[model samples]
Target: MTTQHLEHPTHTHTHGPDCGHQAVSHGDHVDYAHDGHLHREHSGHWDECESGAHTTHDGHTHVHGSDCGHEAVRHGDHVDYVHDGHRHAEHDGHYDDH
Candidate 1:
């Protein structure tokens, strides 16, 4: 008997033109404007192991996945958690409030 380990194929999707486009590293940081001068928020760093849902300082929700890119949507009772292109029942429990 022979045993083989198969690795999942990685798929890449480009948002902008493919002209010398590269992936953004988590160490990258950007400044935001509040009133006049530029303001910094939350160190502007992202964790490599940090997957799934994320909340911004502005109270906005974002979801990230290996299969799907980042998606912004309203959080709260109406939000749904999707994993690998499938909606899990874990998020359905929160729907009871509605």
Candidate 2:
């Protein structure tokens, strides 16, 4: 996976306690889930955070989305869907273990 250095557009508010976004601890920093994406404060701007490595879910057939039957869970920087007894995170064009 490639690391992206894109700044979040239309991000105007500060993220913290009571910021209405889910916060997840990431290494020595924290990331907030915003607008279906993850944002982290860097320098003086908000940067989009993403994972570089993922375990691909091979041979999976069902599709997961906003209206899917599984429950949607807010992970570190993305949403994961609860399926069977585990969580599936969308990565690239496939799903990964959460």
Candidate 3:
């Protein structure tokens, strides 16, 4: 949601310990404060909704009770689309096995 460009181009800035979102890293490691924790997208083994895995993020993949229409969900961390029931998961152009 917030992007802070560091001094160095390659030096990517993290959301720090302020916001409760995932921190994206390009190369450089910048310090930030978002509450008290840092979030980063999952590595290559990541999965998300697009992948169709519907990872067990909140323990619920598809509609919990009714047609929630989870067409596109998720805040971060597991942005990678899981094939379990999700739609897609892409990292650096790497897509999910689904």
lDDT of each: 0.26, 0.73, 0.31
Show model 3 residue runs off by greater than 4 Å.
1-70, 75-84
In the range 1-98, model 1's lDDT, one tens digit per residue, is: 11122221231222222423222222233222212212222323311222234322232233343444532222223332333332222232221110
Q: Write the per-residue lDDT of candidate 3 for residues 1-98, one digit (tens) a residue.
A: 12332233232443444655433332233222223322233332221212223222333323321253323324244433223443333434343322
Candidates ranked by lDDT: 2, 3, 1
Q: Positional deviation of 62 in candidate 1, in angstroms?
A: 18
User: Distance from true position, residue 42, model 1, in Å?
Assistant: 25
Give per-residue CA lDDT, model 2, range 11-42, as digits (tens). Answer: 89899979988776555566777777778898
TM-score of candidate 3 to 2 decimals: 0.19
RMSD of each: 16.4, 5.9, 12.5
Using all chains and alpha carbons, the TM-scores for the candidates as numbered come to 0.17, 0.54, 0.19
Query: Which of candidates 1 and 3 reaches a greater TM-score?
Result: 3
